[model samples]
Target: MAAPNDVQISIPKNDIEEQGFKDFDYSQRAQWLRAAVLGANDGLVTIASLMIGIGAVNEDARAMVLTGFAGLVAGACSMAIGEFVSVYSQLEIEVAQMKREKRVGERGEKEEEREKEQLPNPMQAAMASALAFSLGAMVPLLAAAFIVDHKVRLGVVVGAVSLALVVFGWVGAVLGGTHVVRSCARVLVGGWMAMAITFGLTKLIGSSGMQL
Candidate 1:
């Protein structure tokens, strides 16, 4: 027997390799990032288009401001509820899969492990989506709130939203390791198209002597 002071240490053959193990892939964050980006894009486009549409016919600052506020509240709530429900559904599917996996395991230990990682947190995903949407919607709201001039306010809001869309697109692209310019251009074009369509429709309706 060895003396009490004497110590023996044994290291596994794969210790060095295990120590160097790293999962640099961002796949785990893909779902949450996609939700966040989509939420923000929806918020920006929807609210901005609504504001522009209202502003095209109604020159009253109060009307535009009120419409924008209502849109923000409604959009945010809708986004939150929608995200929660959608993510919860996905969570249920994962739970079902886990249960199935367990049943499979009970049949025999020789069965290979199927699910390697834990399921995503639906609550976390929902919250992130809602928060991102609210943040995005605030850009146009703030622009309309500060400027009293109707035409100038419209222009400012459009510009601000466009800039925000570009920034958001770039951020998403960077996070997802995509082409920044392509993403930015795509978002910019989509935003402008939404605004243009809304503005044109409202203008046509107003010119047709429709009381709104």
Candidate 2:
């Protein structure tokens, strides 16, 4: 017979894994996490869409590659700058809060050092975002690099982008402790939507006899 005061508890496998990874404190990485995952995803989607959009009107592989390369460079720079500014602002706010709390005086050097160690790093965030953007942007570029055929090139680019989207979404979901299927589906669908809209719009405009 079971004791009346006893209660049963169940811990899921995923929960156990998550708990194991909790040693480092996920909240501390929020700033850099956005820099890496979101930046990479943005780069992948933006450059792929640009290439697809350009490919719609012009079948030339050179044009698509050039546009993608340009977008990747510009996007990477923009992402780095934006991430740096955002993280720097966050760091400033947190530091200000610490000062307001007089944590420095009360906690002494060790505590102050610990607080500093926990602070978000702007340079690190900026670099992570830039590198991540470049990595994501390269997927479509590489896929279309060697293929000269117009239709085939476009198809390959789309396929590569789709795969990259799913991968990025899955990685992000895992890191953020979210539902893998939902995240993958969400990003995959969004990427498809963006590319489809861009391609359709560009094709429609090209068909209208507009000199683009």
Tens-place lDDT per residue, model 1, 1-212, is 99999999988868856665444466767878988998899889888999899999998877887888788788878887888888889878977977887877654443334455656777777777788888888888888888888889999999999999999999998888778999999999999999999999999999999977
For residue 97, what is the lDDT in candidate 1?
A: 71
Native-to-model Cα distance after best TM-score fit, residue 147 in candidate 1, in Å: 1.4
Model 2 CA lDDT for position 190: 92
What is the total number of backbone clashes in candidate 1?
0
Runs off by more than 4 Å, candidate 1: 1-23, 106-116
Evaluate model 2: give its lDDT.
Answer: 0.89
Task: Give candidate 2's total backbone clashes.
Answer: 0
Local accuracy of candidate 2 as per-residue lDDT tens digits, 1-212: 78999888998999998778866566666777778888888988999999999998888888999999999999999999998998899889988877866844676785567576768889999999999999999999999999989999999999999999999999888887779999999999999999999999999999999765
Q: Which lDDT values do the candidates have, in the order given?
A: 0.85, 0.89
* Residue 122 lDDT, candidate 2, scale 0-100: 92
lDDT of 1: 0.85
Colliding residue pairs in candidate 1: none
CA error at residue 136 for candidate 1, angstroms: 0.7
